[model samples]
Each structure stands twice: as C-alpha cells, then as structure tokens.
Target: MLEVTLEILRFFVLALALGLFIHADRSVSYGRRGFLLIKIGFLLILFGVFMEITDQLDIPGWGMVADVHVNFYLAKVVGQLAGSVLLLVGLWFWLPSIRTMDEVQEALDRARSELEEHFVARTRELEAEVDRRCKAEAEGRISDERRRILFENSPIGITHGFVGGRFVERNRAYARMLGYDSPEEMAQAQALAGDTFSHIVDPADVERIVGQARNEDYVKDLIVRMRRKDGEIRWIRLEMAMARDHHGRNYYFYAFALDVTERKERSEALERYKRRLKGIFDSLPVGIFVVDRETHTMAWANPEALRMSGYTLDQMIGLPCREALCGDASFCPWGGIEEGVPCTDESFLTRKDGTRLPVLKNMVSTVVDGRESLVVSLQDISEQKRLEELREDVNRIVTHDLKGPIIGVINGCRLLLLEEESLDAELSEMLHLIENQAEKALQMIGLSLALYKIEAGTFTYEPEPVAVMDVVRETLVNLGGRIEDKRLAVSVLLDGGPDPGLGSPMIPANPLLLETMVANLLLNAVEAAPEGGEVSVGLEQGDPVVLTMVNAGAVPEALRETFFEKYSTGGKPGGTGLGTYSARLAAGAMGGTVELSVSDDEDRTTLRVTLPGA
Candidate 1:
C-alpha cells in the first residue's frame, strides 16, 4: 500500500515538474532542452500506467537504449531532477549543485573528479547569464507594478485575504463597498469590519461560502448578507478565487464583490407580490382558468375555478379546457378563441354528476409562448336563474288567478250603475264613484300583468302618437280618491296647445305603456307632495318632447341615488319600489330618458321624461 501511494505521489510531482519546465523555460541557451525533458517525463508516466510488477518487457537492452542508462526508474528520477534545474535556471537564474556526472554523461561515469573541470567551465560560461536574468527580473517587477496599479484602480470590488480570516489587500472599490472613506480606512477598520468575513451576518453562510471556494478553487455569485460600516445589512454577490502564491508559498483567497441588493430586492419583492396576488386570486368568487392556445388544455386553474367546475383540484389540473368547463356544448368557445377574438355569453357548465350549472364567462384570446391562449373569467349565474324562475312563477299566479276578483267587482259595480234610474240622485253618484274606482283597480291589475311581461322580456315595443297631458289627466282622475284624501293641488300646463296629442307635444310610444309611466310618476309626485301643496305637470314641445313633473317635497338624500333601481324605495304607503324602475323601462322602450332632480334647500323634487317627438 505504501509503495503504491509513493508511486502516485511521485507521478504527480514529476508531471507538475514537466509542465512547469516547458512553460517557464524561455532562454535561447536551452534550445528545446526543456521540451525534451518534458517528453522524458511523459514517457515515464506512460511507463507507470502501462507497466507494473506483473508486467515486463524484453528488448535488445532491457531498460537501456543505445549504451545509455535509459532504465525506466532511473529515467523518471533523472527527468525530475533535470527538469527542475532547467526550469529554475530560466526563471530565477539559479543552478543546482551537480555532485555527479553519471546522471548527464553518455558513458555513465560515476567519477566526480573528471567532470569537475567541465562543470567549472560551464559555470564560467553562465556568468553572463546571471546579468541577463537580473535584467529580466527587473522587467518582471515593473510588469507586476503595472498589474498592481490596474488592480487598485479597477471599478469592480476586489479583495485578498489569508485563510486565518485576515484581509491582506483590498481595492478602492472593495473599500467603498463596505462604506469606508478609503482603502486605508478599511484596512485600519479590519477588526471592526469582521476581518475576512466579519460583516457576514450568518456564520453558517460564511462556512458555506468558504467551503465552496476552497473545494472549487473559485466560487461565483455567492450571495451573502453583509453589514456595512453604518450597520446596514446589504446583499452582495461575491465571486471568490483561491490560489497558492508562488513567492510566499501561502494560500490566498481573492474575492470580487458586487452589490446585488437592488436586483435581489426587486426579485424578492416580485416574489412577495406574486404570493400576495395568488392569495387574492384564490379568494375570489369568480373562477379564472388559463388554457394553452395550441392544445386548448388547462394550464392553470385558480381555487375558484375548482369550486365552480365541481371538480377537485387534481381533476382540474391538466384537464382539457373544453372537457372541464363545457364538455356537453356542441359549439365550444375554444374553437372561436383560436381565431383571436374575445367572446362572452351565458352557457352551462356540466358538473361531475352530469348536472348543468349555469355560468356566464368572458373568454379572451391572447398569444402566449409563441401560441394562442385563452384566459377565461367565469361567473356562476345559478342564483340569477333561480330568481328569474321565481319571478316568473309570481307573474303566472297573478295572471291566472289574481285578476278574477277585480273583474267580478267591476261587474257588480256595472249592475248597480244600471239601476241608477230607480235609485236616488245621491245613491246614483255613489254608484258612479264605485264604478270608476272599480275600473281603476281593473286597469292597475292589467298594468301589473304588462309589467310582468316587460320584466320577462316578452313585451314588444308598439309606437303610436301619445299625449303627456292626456295621460296625466287620466291618472289624476283614476287616483282622484287618493288626491282628495291628501288634499293635494295639481296643475297641468300644455305648451303645444289644448289638443296636445295632435302634434308637436305628442311622443311615439305604446299608449298603455305611456299611461303606466305617467300614472306612476304622477302618483309618486302626489304621494311625496305635502297636503295643499302644488304638483305641476308641464309638457314642452320640441325636437324631443319633455314632460316635467314637479312636486313640493324633496326626495330623501339616501334614496335619490338608487331611486330608479328595482326594489329601491323610501318610506311611502303601498310602495312596491318598482314604480320608478318600471317608468325608466317604459321610457327606454320608447327611445326616451327619465331624469330626476331635487332641491333639498327648497324641499322640491322634479322628474323629467324626455321622449322622441311625433
């Protein structure tokens, strides 16, 4: 074992000596002698590899060539000795003591006396060589000084330190990196600055960086948190290099430091931002699915997507987008997404149980990774569908059952009115009032049915010439009882003359819809107005006809914003909160607009309806 170990060690030393001799030998006096010595060393290494104790070679002169002592072991020892001497003679102009000539002479003489005179002669010949070597060494020193100048002035941070955790040299850039005024200041504050790695906050990190540098003889982009002179911790990426100094024979660790705080901070902040955004995405009620444009497969699914699709997270990942979202659809939106168009519609998503879930989605086509991709935002509309069904049920009951009593009451009134001739004058007047009230109730029931149709989206627009004042007068007559109870004073003004329905003041609309809209607005005005206060209804004739209703009471500030929204209303007797909403729908159906204004200081409210002129 010891013999094998010594052989391996000897092999490395001889190999190193061969390389050094060939590289450093530059003198013309050697004349390829250094290269010849390298070849000899190479042959010895090959011998060691190919030949062992069990291997032997028979030649004309075994281990010797042409009367020369060319034995393998002796050749290896000689190559090492001669290569070292020649290489030293070139670089440092030094000679080794030659005590024997048998190592160099062809006859293999071991006598030192005969070669002593020749060695003396060779020594005299090398006197001039010493002078040349001195000149070369001086030039080398100048070159080294230039290198040192470049190192000091370099912008990149550079530092050199011994293994004992003491910095031997630092450039200006390195000193500035640690927040010192100058390199000298940094040198003086070596103890405070953590010597070699005192600024490294983590001891484990220090060990890692050092170990990495030692093992690899170089380390690049080794990030560490280092403290500055002001005690501010910053991230730095150190490129470390290690080497043995040929002059001192000591190991040195050199580092090129770069301030990576900004880049690292930005990366960390971006990562943090990604985490926060992912949290928000997972918390949303709407589902978001990203699909590959080429394959149309699910690339990413947010948490909401899993919930909305009724699929487990594992099921949703990598599933075909069409299969996961709308597997039952004949025409998939993915096909259209391939054309780079954005599409949105209400559709049904099939769940795991084959139950259809109503959904509304916005699918946009975009390019990603050199291919088309779809980013789908989904909303579950099941609740909206349920509410619509409930509303339809309510409307159905009113249409089929609730109108019977109103018609029966009207028929009873008609029978009593027919016997007016046999009754007294006061009783006849009472019967006439009952008949009018009953007719008004019937009209309200019919209007309710029409509103239901309008809500169901089954009502069609019927445009006809209609008058604002005529509708207003009919509403006042129908609501006469309520008006008298409130004691509200109402006034009507027509700007298009008495026959307002004949010309400019007339608006094109379904007469029934116009009447409903006017009656609701008039009722709101009457109900909001104080007793004995005025409700002025005015009709203006122009390119667009305007009907303005002004009441003596201001709308509540809180209700003003959502006054026209469905199911939005303030405290009022018999208020269903659908009056303004229906009125706005009616005006919209007739290509008109409705606007409300209030003067809180004056306690007044005005609703203006702008309609297309006849």
Candidate 2:
C-alpha cells in the first residue's frame, strides 16, 4: 500500500512538471518571460520524480522511458541531461526581455548624466555673463561690433541704399545676386536705373518693387528677371522694407534677394505640358470621359467620347454616363475605381438608333474638377468583333463542307495502304505516309470545328460514363503509322481495381470530345518524342480523373509559357501551335483543365488533363 501511494505521488509530480513545461513558453500565442523561467525551474525540480518512477513503472512505446534498455540509472542521467537543456533553452529565450529592461536603465542613466552636465554648464555661463555685463555697463562700453558682424555675415542679401538715388552699403550676397564682383563695387556704383542695375529685365518691375517697399515699408516675394554675372538671364525674388530715422525722415531701403530660376522654370514647364496634353486628349482615338465619382455623372467629355456616344458637346456635358451611352446603369463598373485599382470589362453601348455596339471599357481613379473623380475610357471594337465572327462563320462553313471530300480521301488512302504487301518498298512507304497525312488533316479539321463551337459558346455536351482507356487505345491505333515512323516505345498504365469500370479509368464526359482530346495528346507526344525515345500515357480515375502524357523529347524553351495559348507555335517544325490550344478548349468544354510542363534539363515534356470522375 505504501509503494502504491509513492508511485501515484511520483506520477502526479511528473504530470504536473510536464504540464508546466508545456505551458512555460507560450511565445507562439500568449507568453511572459518571467513566468516561463519560473515554470521551467519548477519543471527541473520535478524531473527527478520521473527518474525515480522509471524503476517501478515501465512506459509503453514511443515515450522517454519506454525502451527496455532504459533502467532507473539511465533514466536519472537522461532526466538530468534533458532537464538541464530545457532549462538552458528557456533561459536563453528569456534573456531578450532582461536585456530590454537593462537597455532602458542604461538610456535613463545617460539621459540623467547629460541633463546634469547641461544644467551645470548653463548655470556657469549665466553667472559669468552677468558678471561681465555688469562690468561692461559700468565701463560705459556699447556692443556695436556684434551688430556689424551680423550685418556682414548674414546669408540673406541685405542692403542700406538711400531711398531714391545712391548706394551706401550692401552685403556680399546682395552684390553677387546683382551680377557684381563684390559689395565694394556695388556700393561704389549708383543705385539708380543705370549700370548698377542693368540686370533688371523690366523698368516697370522696378517701379512696382520700389513703390511697394516705399509705401508699405515692406515687400515680399516680388519676382523679376535679372541677368547674372555670366550674361545669363535668371529669375530673382526680392523682400524689402524701408528704414526711417526717429524724425520719420526716410534714410535707406533694406532688401534681400534670392535666386528663383529653377522654381520658375518648373512652373512654366508644367503649365505648358498640361496645355499640350489637353490638345492631345481631344484627338485621341480612345473615348475619354471624366465623371463625378460619387454620382457617376459625366462632367466633361472629350471630342472622341462625344462622337462615340453620338452626342454633341452641349448634349453630353451633364448627362449621366448611363443615360448618355448605355441608356441604363447596368453596364457601369461600380461606384468608381479606387486608387491603384483599375476596372476593365467588355460592355455593350446602346446607340441612339436602338443598335447595340460592343466596347472595351476601362475605368480608373483620376483628378477632375480639381477633385478626385473617375476617368472612363471606351474603345470601340464592334467592327473587329463582327469581322472575327464572320471569319469563324466562314471557317465553320468551309470545314463543314469539306468534311465529306476529306473523309473520302482518307478512305481512299486507307484502301491504298492495305495493298502494301503487293507493292514495292518505296511505293508502300509513300502510301503509308499518304494515309498518315490524310488522317492528320481529318483530325485538324475536326479540332478546328470543335474549337469554333467552344468560341461561339454553342458547344454541345452530353456527358455519360466513358472508359478512358478505350479512347486512349483508339487514339494509339489511329496514330500507329506515326508511332512506327518515330520508332518510339510507348506504354499505357492504368491502376488495378476489381470492378471493370474502376480497373479501366472512366470519366463522365462526351465520348467524341474525350477522343479528340486524347488524339491531340497522343499526336503531340508522338511529335515531341525523339526518333527512338520513349513515351508514356497514364490514367487514374477517382474523385477527379487525371490523364497524363509524358515524352522523352523536350518541349522547346521558348514555347513553355504559351504552350496552351493560341497562335503561339514558334520554333516547332511542322507545328500549327493550335493542337494544344484546341485540346485545352475542348477539355474546358467538358469540365476539365489541361496543364503542361517541360523539363529541358531532363529532356522530358509532360501534359496532364483532369476531368470530372464518373
């Protein structure tokens, strides 16, 4: 009974220690360093209890004391080692908080030291200055030297020229701004409207400046053009005030001058660019309309916009964009485009004559009426769309009409290929080539028609349970000649299952469309495979059916990104670039997606199609 009670106490101590350790560092959630250190220290103290229990009780598998080789002595040593490590790691993580506290203490100490020194130095200077000031006042000495030094060293251009005529004194900066070598030369020259001031651009500007300074005793930021010492004209600003004696008799005019050439040029350039942009806006091909962001009502419309909506300048000035072009508000993007977000969409505009016009619309935040607003641009593509539809129509008609003749040609080639045993080797090979080419042409036409259906949004889809291997087999048989020509090793892998439907991968898809996608996949693999390399086709049916094709020949580096994009067939010989593109569209039509990747380093290309599982 005493042993049982001791074992229970040991177990409880170990459990409590583990609980503390688990809750010690909540840094990932909620944590306190001081509490964590204390928890770890307590855990170390209880670890010996676990070591003592190792002799009485054996833990199950996958635990610290579960091993048969781990007895009481080993457990005690391990417990000490692990406890030490845990305690160290916990202390390590807690040091940053201690350092933070210490750093604040150090900063406070330095701040106190600096404040004490500042006070002492200020007190000493005040005491010394008071004594010096008393001595100087008793000696009857005036501080005229400080005033003279400040006047000469001031960065601002200061002058003390007589009110109406000759110059008296000037600073170096004032003389330099006036295109003179020094203050002496400027002071020697007369301050009237002659050689001393030949740099001033206009006599009226001078009159205005003198008038403002004389009447108001102060003038600020009076801009004028002046010639520099190097004969270059530059802009300058003047701020001045008149000085008078105690009797109110004018003595001299004090002024400061600053170089303002760069600021002037930038202002002028911005104004000119704005004017030029305004002119270009009217002539732009795209329709531009500025509207109030809150109301979405057009405040201004450029000429092209007015023409696009078939509205005159006066008519479109204040109309809501919907009322002006769309006749309704349904086509608008939204309240307005927010900053950094542009809205792009295709919408139809209703003309005045009740005809609908297709337009590509773009809207973004822009400034209008001196406030934040929306700028909407519309590009008319109705003619381009009409032409595209017409071209597709022509293609559909041509492919539809040529089907019979093409099938007859294929049948004839197949018939000729059958007589290869009775013909010469060259003749037999030619016949085989004819059959292969004919079959490929038939596949191209069928794919083209299928793609046209996808684009026209009229593709018919009747999905039923389909054995994927059946279509893959048919595609392999159809491409036998091409496969033989390339001498490629091919394999088809299917997952093993008891049920026939599960054994052979099956998907819910249109049989004809599935066959077409498979045909394209097989044909592309055959073309990509090296002359005598290997190709593999794999299928797996589950929640989603995946069909994979891998070829030994690498896909070109240039075509990887646009492998499924239309008209992107560059660098591949005898390639229309439409095969993969059409396959993707066909797969999408059947609720599937086609993904492709190529590894030039491995000399392998892979294509995968995922379809809805049956």
Candidate 3:
C-alpha cells in the first residue's frame, strides 16, 4: 500500500508539473522546435506515469500474468528513462529562451513603471489644457451667440449647407426671401431635391453658378434667377465662400444673398433703352456728341459724330472736345457759361485734314449720371453755303451783264416808236407792242433779283394801289396762246360778279409784281386745265383781299403737301417748278399768303391768295 501510495504521489507530482508547463506555455511563446520537443517530453512523462498507475491497478488478465507484468515494468522504466532524456534535451533547447524571456520581463517591468509616471504627468498637463480650452470655448460661445443673433436678424439672406447638398441651416431672411414661411420649410424642400438651392434656381443658372463655385471656391455678387415658393421669379445676387477642413477637403458652403429684382430690372430696362437710343443716333444723318461739363472732355459720341470727327471711338473717348471735334474751344457753346445753358451758332469746324467745314450747331445742356453735360447736334451746311454763293454770282451777272443789253434794246424800241407817224396803223401798233414786250423782258430780269432777295429775307417792300382787273386782263392776254392750245374757258370775276372796268376794287401791291404774279397763276391754270377745261379767277374785297383761281385736275395726293415749296412739281414736262414757288414768294413780299385746296370728287384744284386790302 505504501508503494502504491508512493506511486500515486509520483503521478500527482508529474501531473502537477505538466499543469504548470501548460500554464507557462500559454503565458509565453516557446519557439516551434522547443515547443514540440517539450510537448513530446511531457507526453512521454505522462505515459510513464500512466504505466506506473497501471501497474498499481489489480485489473484484468494481462497484469496478472508474470511475463506481462515484467514487460509492463520494463516499459515503465523505458518510458521514464526516455522521458528523462527528452526532458533534459528539451530543457537544453528551451533554457536560453527562458532566460531571454526573463530578461525581457524585467525590462518590461521597468518600462511599465516609467510609463505610469509619464501618464500621471501627462494627465496633469491635459487637465490644464482642458481648463484653458474650456475658458476659450466659453468666450467663443458668447461671441458665437452674438454672431448668430446678427446672422438671424440680418436683412440679407444667409445660408449654410453642403455644396450640392441640402441646407444644414438657413436664416429667416433666406426663408422669407424665397417665399417660404420658415427656414424649416425651405430646408424640407432642399432635402427633397438633395441639393443646396438648385431646385429653386433656373437650370441654366444653376450650372453656371455651381460651376463657378466649384472652380473658384468663392462667388461674389453673382446674379441668378430663382423661382420663389409661390412661383414668382426673383433676381438674387449671391456672395458665397466655401469652407474646407484641416486637410483642405470641402466641408460646407456658406452664402450671403440679396434680392435685387427691382434694381436688376431697372438696369436691364436702362440697357435696352440705351441700345435703342444708340441705334437711333447711329442711323441719324446728323452728328451728335456729348461732352462732360466739368472736365470739358468728350463723354460720348454717336457713330456719325465719330465719323465726322475722323476719330475712332477708342481714340475719342475722354479726349478734350476741342481737340477731338471743333479745334477751337471757343466755339463750344457751353464754354464760359453756366451749366444747362443752350446756344446755337453757324460756325466753321476743322476737319481731320485741316480743311474748313461749315456746320450749323445746336447745343443744349443736360444731366447724365448726376453730372452736368453738353449735348451737341450739328448739321453739315457746306452744300447750302455753296448754293448761296452760286446764287449771288448769278444775281450779279443778271444785274450787270444782262441789264445793259436789255436797256439798249429798250432805247432802240423807243427810237423806232418816235418815227411811228410815217408807218401805217398796223406798223405803228406793232412798234408799240414790241416796245411793251421789250420793257416786260427788262422787268422780268429785275424780278429774278427781287425773287432771290425775297427768298433770303432781305427784300424791301413798297406798296401801291394796283388795279386787279387790269392785271388779270393783261395776264389773260399774255397766256392767250397757252389758253388757246388747251382750249380752256377763262373768266375773271369781282366779288363773284363779272369783271368790272379797270382800276376798280384795287389792292395795295407793286403793279409790276402783281402783274407778274397774275401771269404765273394764269400760265399754271392754262397748263393744268384739260382740253376744253374751264379756268376761273375770283376776287373778293375785304379787310384782306382774296384771289381764288380754279382749274381742272385735282393735285396729286403725294405732292399736295410740298406743292408750294421751292422746286416741287409733278406731271408737267419742262415745268421749272419755280412758277408757284415764285408766285408764293411774291405774294408773301407784299403782305400776302397763298394756299392750295383740291376737290378730288369734283376733279378740280383751287389756288387761294390773300393780300392786304387797300
């Protein structure tokens, strides 16, 4: 029993050692070769123990046999011996490793102690940093509160959100601006679209504004059209900045917006108006220029003005008007005068080639962009001046050259008339008519100069009593050939009655002028009258005497307005067009006016002349 007890005790000790080895193996790593060797050694030791335990058991037939028992004992001894050898070998292999583990453990304990000390010190420093950060956070919160108040109450719209994402926060102004009742409503809509404000923005504008934001990370005063909640379109100007995280990654976008619909509309309207005005000015034949009042520089010049001044728009802008336009500054009507004064002048302008050009200039002061300015309108009058000079030359030739020959003819006719007694009645009458016709030619030559003077507003008037009946009689006699060719029925009336004797119901006018005027009317009447057409002249005596000449053929509709104007005529071959013009001028010179009226249904034209009565 004691032996058995000893064996049991031995087995227990071996088992306990195996348990300790397993515990150690779990806590520390044994190299693969060492682990395998130790494992085999321990298994052999357990096998020896198992054999010894078996030897103690009084069991079956095998152990009861002597040979079996001896074999078992031998096995037990071999197992123990092999186990002892293997354990020693394993220990040999594992000892250095165990020593290394022990040293590593010692070093680890020392490092752990140092780490604890450092952790304690670091905790204290962290506590101080936390305290400082907490104080700073408190101050920051107060400032943030004030900023929040301002952001919420600001008149301008403010919004914060992820770019291309739903809004995280929005100010009241932003909500109200978009016609939303509250910020939450706007946010709800934004979330539905999963975008910042693209749903409200015009599609084209969204692409442009968002593209700009992505490229620049900032947008300033970008105007976009956005639809409000109620479907109204509004113009919004956005100024935005994108926020980035520490790693320069996009975080969110914050934006300021203002409703600029009214201002934008006004600006657009003004731009359109400017475009139209520029079109008109460019189309005008007259040159228009705008000059600054304070700087005396060219503010604006129409296309015609630029062309006339021989300068490009780029070259003329902001240049002094004197240099750009009329070389002499003294010609500027606004010079040396208070702003807003107006003036007109006929002056000479210096062209780019240093040639003189006559211009009729009208200048008026105006205000532009809160600054006083001058608006100058000019017409090129070179053609008119040339025509006036030509007219003067013609008048000189008629007075000096033609009059001499005409006077000599009149003297020759007078000499012939003195010898009329030797001639028969027909010869004598023919001489008298020749003298009368020659005098008329001289009178007509003088009338040409008189008509020019009347047109120039330099004619002097001298009125005398003139017999209207005698003048009418003489005009009819002069136009007898034309009247006969047209087969016209001509008649003269006094106060709607038949023509009376000569010198009755006379008018105050030049006798020669009256005769010339009457002759022009009769000629026009005879020409206008159709074959066998009637021409009637009616005179009325009142405060102002009235002469009405009626003929067939109504005036053409297109020519009626300008019929009395100089060089205006229609449908008459070889017509000088100056007959009616001269007739009107002669009437005006004698305090008279002429008007034309047409009766389309009656197919007639009436020429009415009003002259001062005697």
Candidate 4:
C-alpha cells in the first residue's frame, strides 16, 4: 500500500505539472510549434507516471496493456526520455523569443517618452506665435487710427488721388478752400465733373502743371489760378508728389495747397507802379543816377543821366560812382551824407570827353531792392554862372566910370568952401552942405569898388593900428540923423563902464575896413531899432577885443539864418540888406568874426564882433 500510494502521488504530481504548463500557455506568448511541442511533452510524462501507478496496482487490464507494450517499465522510461528531450528543445527555442520580447518593450517605452517631450515643446511655440500675432494686429489698428486723425485735421489743404483724375481722399480744409460745404460735397462735385479739372483750376494752368508732374513725378510751390464755387478767382500755391510702388510704377499722388491771392495781387500792383516810375525817370530833364552803397558802383542811370555822361547804359551800369560822376575817387557823395537826409552843393561832373561840367548836385541815401543805395540828381548851372559873371563885369565898369566924375564934384565943392569969407552966412552954409554931400558921393563910389574887389577875393589887406573907440564914435555920429529919425536913444561904454582911465582901444586892422565895419554895424542898429527904442554899444579891452551892439528890436525869423548873406533882406522898406553883409565882409578881412544873437526873452537883437587887439 505504501508503494501504491507513492506511485499515485507521483502520478498526481506529474498531472499537476502538466496542468500548470497548459495554463501558462494561455498567459504567456510562444511560437505555435514550440507550444505544441511543450504540451505534448507534458502529456506524455503524465501518461508515463499513470502507467507506472497502474503497474504498481497490478490490475488484470493493466497487465494486458503492459504485455502489449512488451515492458511496462521500459515503456515508462522511454516515454519519460522523449518527453524530457522535447521539453528541452521547446525551452531552447522559446527562451531566445523571450529575450527579443524584453528588447521590444524597452524600445517602445523610450519612443513614447521622446514623443511626449516633443509634443510639449511644440505646444509652447504655437502659443507664443499666437500671442505675437495678436500684439501686431493691435498695433496695426492703432497706427491706422492715428493716420486717419492726422489726415483729417491737417491745416493746409491736402488731397490724395490716382495718377489719372480719380480722387481717393480729401481733407476738410481742402474742401473749404475750394468753396464747398463739406468734403462729401466736394467729392460729389468732382465726381460729376467727368474727368475735368477746368471746373476748379484754370484750364491753361492745369495743362502745364499736369504735364510737368507727369514728366518729373513731382511739383513744388507751383502757383495755379483756381475758380471758387461763387465765381471768384484765387491764386493757389501747390506742392505735390507721386507715390511709386515697389515696381517703380506710379500708384497715387498727394498734394498740399495754400491760398496766395492777396500776395499775387500786391506783386502785380508793385510791378505796375515800378513801370510808371521808370517812365517818369526816363522823361526827366535833370540827370538821375542810382548807386549801390556798399560797392560805390552805378546800378542804374536814367536817360538824362546817360546823355549827360555821354555814355551808353551798358558803359555806365557798372562804373564806380566816383569815376563816372565826380571823377574824384576820394570824394564820394555817400561819405558825408546821412541816410534819409539830402545834401545839396555845387560839384563838377567829368564827361566822357574829359571836360568838366558845372552842376548843382543833390544826393540822398535810400533803400532800393532791399539794399542800401544812393540817389543822385544833378542840374546844370553853367548858364546861371555865366550871367552872374556878366553882371559883375557891368557893375565894375559902371563903378570905374563914375569914380572920376564924383571926384570932380567933390573938388569943385571944396574950392567953393575955401572962399567962405566972400559969401553971406546962408550962402556959406549952402556951399558947406554941397561940399559935404559931394564928399559923401565920392566915398560911396570908393566903397562900391572896394565891395567889388572883396567879392572877387582880390582885395589887398593893409594892416595898421586903428583906434576902435574912435571908429565906434565916428560911426555913431554918422548914423545920428537915422537915430533921431527913428527916435532911438544910443548908449556907448568902454570896458563895460561909462568911462575908463585908459585911452581909445586900438586894433590891428585895415583903417578903411575898420571904419566901414563900424559905420555899417551902427547904421544897421539904428535902422533896425524900433521907434523910441534904445541901442547900447559895449567894448571890452583885451588881447582880443570884443564889441557888442544890442538893440531893442529883434531880427525877423525868416532872415535870421541869412542875416549876413549877400542880398538877403527882411522886406524892410528901401532896405538894401547890404549893411550887415558889408559889415561881415570887412570884419572878416581884418581877421575878425561877426555874430548875431536874438534874445526871445528880452525881445532884443545883439551883434557881437571879435577882433585881434594891438
């Protein structure tokens, strides 16, 4: 029983091993041939153990099955040997497949991890690109808004259009400038015009401007005449440029415009005035020249100026003023003349022939064409000068012819006076008056010649010591009749006092000139004194003696500047105006000066004479 039990246990152990092998076949993978081989080997081993158990039990049917196999133990041994061989062969085949399975699993795990990492990185990149695109789109919208605002609010007239006449956009200012209510109205009008600029711009101007823009692709500061909706013509200044695409083809045109009608009108008016002025200058009788201040060169010469200079306009245009007009380079009229002030004097002009012509020249500094310039006018004074010389000659001949006759009358009167004892008192007095009057006539003739010589600058000066006090007393006595007629009271003083211990003050002067000066001054004082007015004469004794004569009457305002000029008069009845003139000349000949002062406060006139004393 123990043996049977052990065999049975062996048999059960083998069957259980076979059952575990069959179960593992379902859970694990192996080639079909190898699995079949393993299953057949396990069944054979179980059958061998079952046969051994049956042999051990010695049953009648089991003996018969053993006899048919020839030996039960041998059969069991054979079956076990074959099963072991098949099991070993199956393990040999399936073990390499198991290693291959392990390698495939490791490779699949690595590929999955790599794919996960790549997917994560690509997702981040996609998100950043979306964010960047969103930011760019936002900035583009802002830029478009800014451009719209700028285009609408620009002050100057602005417009955009195709190269052909199709308008794209226009600002409010541009619309208003063209006399439209709004931009839309302007656009509607432009659309209705049917490819025409004649409705807005001058047709002729449009032709030229459009032609130029087409050729040059730009136009700047081009002035065009435009017509408003209300039928007013205006001048517009335009600046336009063409926008080209990347292929160098014109895409569109933009323009800026401003109204300049007032400026254009003013320019036209100025041109007209200049034309009139030039006409007048050409027809003038006197010579007129315009000179540049900085270069001292002639800029323009009128017709008269050209004729006087004996040169054509081309020859005189760029010549120096000193060379062309005055012939003295050192003496330019601009040197002494101030701006806006006129200078008039006598000067000589050198003609092309090298002959000097006398002229009275007037010069004034002024602005011409925005630059400092000088305007000079010259009047020929040759005929006037010749007539003055002729008059002087006649006066000289008359004075010479009258001197001998006047001397004869004075001598005859003197002879009559010498025989006073033979005549009665009345007859003797008459003869004496005749002699005095004749002497006065002779003195008058001599004075006339002396005056002529002084004017000619040919007078000979003979210096001698003269008693100024005695001369003054003699002049007062000579004017006594005039003083009495005017009812004037005359006063004389020496060294500011009534009388001084010193004798008559002496001055080194020509005796005749000294007497004439004193007499003329005193006579003028007497004549100018008002009725019942007073005249005061004061003398100061010094190295330079000063003589002052004051009268109650003041000089006339009109003649104050020319009081001592030759032939100047204040419209006094029978007044020669030569008293002050001759007095000044005689004083100047004796190296002296005569001055006149009018005191408005005291209503008085004072004549002061200063001379060298001996």
Q: Pick the candidate with the highest TM-score.
A: 4
Number of clashing pairs, model 1? Answer: 2
Encode model 1's per-residue lDDT on 240-335: one tens digit a residue: 878766654436788898999999999999999999999999998999888886776887778888877777877776777776576465666665
lDDT of 4 at 236: 92
Residue-wise C-alpha lDDT for candidate 2, range 1-614, written one tens digit per residue: 56646966876876776685566445423225544654665465455555556545544542344444555444455455555666676667765666675777798899999999999999999999999989898665345566577678887777668765555677887778767888877655544535545667788877786677567667788898876657788888888778877888666687777888898899899899988998999889998888777776778888888778787778767667676554355655555457657877677665545576788878888777677777778889989889988988898899888888878887886887787688899987887787777776777788677678787798787788887887887788889998999899988887532223233555788766787789877898888788999988888768688888999977777678678887767556887877787788889999999998888788998998899887
Per-residue CA lDDT of model 3 for 1-614, tens digit only, reads 88778877987887888777777777656554665577677778777776766666755654455544553654466567787778888878887888888888898999999999999999999999999999999999999999999989999999887766656788999899989988988878877877665445577887776676556677898988888888899988989898777878666788899999999989999999999987999999898888888998988888887777777788777988776455475555455555566666677656666676788887888897788888888788889999989978887686768878878877887898788787788987877787787788888888888887887788899998888877888778878888888888988898989886556677789876787788887788889888999999999999799999999988899889778777788869999788898898899899998899999999999999999988
Clash count, predicted structure 4: 0
lDDT of each: 0.75, 0.75, 0.81, 0.81
User: Model 4 lDDT vs. the true structure?
Assistant: 0.81
lDDT of 1: 0.75
**Per-candidate TM-score against the hidden true structure:** 0.51, 0.57, 0.47, 0.69
Ranking by lDDT: 4, 3, 1, 2
Better of 2 and 4 by TM-score: 4
Q: How many clashing residue pairs appear in each of the predictions shown? A: 2, 0, 0, 0
Clashing pairs in 1: 194-198, 293-372
Clashes of 3: 0
Q: lDDT score, residue 559, model 4?
A: 86
Kindly give the stretch of ten consecutive residues in candidate 3 with the minimal lDDT sum.
Answer: 62-71
